[model samples]
Target: MEKKKLNHYDVAEVIDRFEINKVFDCFTLKNWLAIGTTNKLKPSHSEVLEEARQQLSIKWDEWNEEELKMNFVSMVIFVSQLDVPKHINTYFERKLSGKVNEISISVTVDCMLASPTYSGRPKNPYFFLQEFKRSLGDNHDPEGQMLAAMILSQKLNEDNEPLYGSWIQGRFWYFTTLTNKDYCVSKPFDATEPEDLLQIVYVLRKLKELILARVTP
Candidate 1:
């Protein structure tokens, strides 16, 4: 007897033949994507994300000082979301007894990679700072770092006006870290390569599909 050759159709048939409706749900799809990204299946961009997830799971509770430093870079990248700026502003306004409009967020760290001197350089960038801490330790102080970064990033004018500059414009942060054994990677706000952006898009699209499915039927 000879082994049968399998094609795309054969694979599709296998999936289609299964009662997928029973298992398909938002949680399932999200987990599937997470697994796929973690396992580095087929698609290549998910490799880093998967590695980050594995690192998070293993080091989440250990809280070893060495691991904290090693994991910090990935955590920084992982938690750096678009909504960070708004949250920082809200918190500061309440804490300082100032209006929301009075607060401004800036990204400091004056490295060449973080320099605002050049166009397209990672200027004032915002990040989900609290999430970065949570990635390190459960007892990590969120209010400390998040508030510090926000307060430090703001500008003060002679007349007490918020003078924001595009060079120092948006709420963004910069991070550089070592991964695996020898490689060091640095990403600035808006500094990600096109491929990483595409991976984010792919994950977001999958998430949207899962969400839409929940609303239908």
Candidate 2:
């Protein structure tokens, strides 16, 4: 049987066929996006962010996906300090696929953080972060790719926990949460804006707290 690539899916296909609901309560959305960025960054972290911000202001519209990841996205991920390099680490371009409700699904996660087994592989996935060069249009689908990875994460995990993921395009970053059949997407957090960039860092740090709080091994 031919397998379905998760990147091939868009938001509508995930909602229409898989029965996932996009409608979320206003409060819930606010709570998810409520990490405090105002007083959180140290001076050292601030220096790195300012550099990244400057680079982004100059080149956001000109870079492709790879350039974006290498320049801007990596800096954000670094300032986020996902976790110590001990056991938890981030992996890139990793392939994941599983059977969800009898339908075959697969995806290449652009970046994810998770605990590693002794053999050096992601044992329990924690979050997905993808960078998109194209805006929301027919040629690409950020939400669909995100949802597909999250759904695949659910199937592979089976831990009954909420999943976190995001789609980033130049200055705009949209965070998402999938818990059970309900999912929510936050308003775009613009990286060009200093405040929003801080919020973006906080959210990335927040993922670390979320993962460590989990009961799984």
Candidate 3:
């Protein structure tokens, strides 16, 4: 028999197989968003966010994953100062183990913002951004893929800290968190909205602060 090709949905199914306790039963969604706010972006951060918002307004639907990521999303991340401790790019494949099937899983993220270790490799992944084209229709599962990446990062996290992630399809951005096997996803925050864009930037800034605190000497 041929070996199966696993997509993100398969990975999610595998995660579902684990007997993890969900915290939503214990805590409200509002409390989750407030999990950590070590730092927030200043008003200056809005300058770049406005630029990205304008660029995305006209070009969002026209670009593919790379184009959207590089031209808009990456730009926003850079402006938000999330890339302070480490640079950002693609082409790295992360291999992970699944608890459900006891098989190896591999995934490549579109853009990963991480803190570098002493050797200068991506040591702690602070935030991940994934792109799923609306053009792909029902075939693409951006949320599933983001969840899978979070799951993989959770496994890689020596401290078992909560992982942060987001996915973009068209102009909408959806954020999520994975902690202690419990997953909590936020509602769609349209990139076109000024407040929504600011929130996204704020989250990135917070992640940067969190990473810096952990990695900085």
Candidate 4:
């Protein structure tokens, strides 16, 4: 008999299997984003974000998954600037797996931040983002996928710190965090809006700072 794969599970199934509790308008997520920075965006990053907002305003509903990734998502990531001096860099289309007692979860993450040991391999994943153009026609569970990635990253890190992740639905992005069995999701941040897009970049930047603290001596 073969083991169960994560992609086959829906968000509810993943929650039930892991005994995880979901909180809407989660306080933890709200606080996480709040601690993000008060400094104004650099001119270069501001330009990048403005571009992404403009593009999403026009193409939010028009883009397919690939186009959303290449056009809209790329701009947000560019503004976030996850690459750090500590070698905690970003990787794409990576596989993550972990076992919890008798159950196991495996997922191919769309985008992740991890410290690479070799040239192309992610050694310790800290953050993740799973995305799709739209939820209806695709018939895929991006939340479940993102949850699985966060679980594995938590296990691999073996650190008590909360794990962070996000899942994109068309032009909206939902930030998530897992601490023990509590899974919290922030309200969707609309990429087409200037203010929400800035907040998205701020959260990403805050995440990088958190990861650096864990990895740095």
Candidate with the greatest lDDT versus the true structure: 4
Alpha-carbon RMSD to native, per candidate: 22.5, 2.5, 4.2, 2.1
Per residue, candidate 2 scores C-alpha lDDT tens digits across 126-171 of 7888745636667367778778888878878888888888998768
Q: In candidate 3, what are the lDDT values of residues 124-202, reduced to their tens digit? A: 5656677545344454577666666666666676677767777888888877777777766678888888878877776
Model 2: residues >4 Å from true position, as ranges? 1-7, 26-30, 37-39, 85-87, 136-139, 215-217
Give Cα-based local distance difference scores for all models: 0.29, 0.78, 0.63, 0.80
* Candidate 1 vs 2: which has more lDDT: 2
- TM-score (all chains, Cα) for each model: 0.30, 0.89, 0.75, 0.90
Clashes of each: 7, 0, 0, 0
Q: What is candidate 4's lDDT per residue for 1-217, written digit by digit as tens?
A: 8775554647787888778888765665776788534747899889877877888798888888888888878777887888985568888788887786456887878899888886657887878899664554333688888887787677788877788899998888988999878899888988888888888888888888878877888
Error of 4 at 138 (Å): 6.2
| Model 4 clashes, total count | 0
What's the lDDT for candidate 4?
A: 0.80
